[model samples]
Target: MDEDLMRALREDRGVKATALAKALGLSRVGIYEAVKRGEIQATRIGRRIVIPAHVARRLLGIEMEAA
Candidate 1:
C-alpha cells in the first residue's frame, strides 16, 4: 500500500465501516457485525457510530502517530 494512502486511512474520521471494509476486502455488513460483536471498539453518538481514528489504526495493525 502507498504511504500516502496509509496516511489518509489513518487520518480518516468519517464512518469507517465502508472504507475499512473496502481496504480489507470485507463486506460492510461484516464490519458492522464485528463491531456489534465487540471485535472492534466503537461509540454511538446520537444516531451515528463513530470509530476513532487511532482505534481504527490499532485494529488494522497500523502504527500510531509519533508523540
Candidate 2:
C-alpha cells in the first residue's frame, strides 16, 4: 500500500468502495467483506457507500492525527 495514497484518502472525508478497493489492490467484493466483518466503517449516502478516511487509517495501522 502506498502511504501517500492512503494519506490523501485520509485527508478526504471518505472514499467510495470501488475506489478504495482499487487503492488497496483488492477486489470490490473483498472490500465489501471487510465492511461486513467490521474492519472498516461505512456510510450510505443516497445510493453510494463511503468508507471514512480515519477508519481506513486505523484498519491499515496508520498513525492517526490528534483529534
Candidate 3:
C-alpha cells in the first residue's frame, strides 16, 4: 500500500458503515448485508462497525487527499 495513503487511513479513523452507506446511496442495513456476505471488510470498534479506509478506498476506487 502507499505510505501516504496508509497515514491518511490512520488519521481518518476508517469509514463508518453509516457514512459509507450514505456515500453509496445505500441503506445502513445494506452496508451490513454486504459485510455479512463477505463483500466488504469491516471491524467492530465497541458498538460501531467501521470499514478499513484502505479496504473502503479500494472497494470504491476512491482516493483521499493527503494531510
Candidate 4:
C-alpha cells in the first residue's frame, strides 16, 4: 500500500456513510442496507451512522496507528 494512503487511513477518525458511498460510487441506501445487514462495519453515534477509520484500515489491509 502507498505510504500516503496508510497515513490517511490512520488519520481518519470517522468517515460519513454518505461520503463513503459517494466515493465508492454506491447508493447511500445500499450502504445503509449493507450496514443493517452487517455486510459493512459501522457504528452509530447517537443517531448518526459513522464508518470508523479502523474498519477502512482493516478492509484495505492497512493496520496502523496515528502518529
Name the top TM-score candidate: 3
- Clashing residue pairs found in predicted model 1: none
Which run of 10 residues does model 4 get worst, by summed lDDT? 1-10
Model 3 misplacement above 4 A: 1-12, 65-67
- The per-model lDDT (C-alpha) reads 0.68, 0.74, 0.77, 0.72
Cα lDDT, model 3, residue 48 = 90
Better of 3 and 4 by TM-score: 3
Cα shift from native, residue 54, model 2 (Å): 0.9
Query: In model 1, where do residues sit more than 4 Å from their true spots?
Result: 1-15
Order by TM-score, highest first: 3, 4, 1, 2
Q: For model 2, how does the per-residue alpha-carbon lDDT over 1-67 read when each residue is reduced to its tens digit?
A: 6555566665766767887787668898999888888877898789787888766666556675664
Residue 44 local lDDT, model 1: 78
lDDT, candidate 3, 1-67, per-residue tens: 4454445465765878877776667899999999989899899889898898888777666677765
Q: Candidate 4, residues 1-67: lDDT per residue as tens digits?
A: 4444445466777767776666567898988998999988999998888888777656555567546
Question: Model 1: how far is 40 from its true place, Å?
Answer: 0.8
TM-score for candidate 2, residues paired by index: 0.63
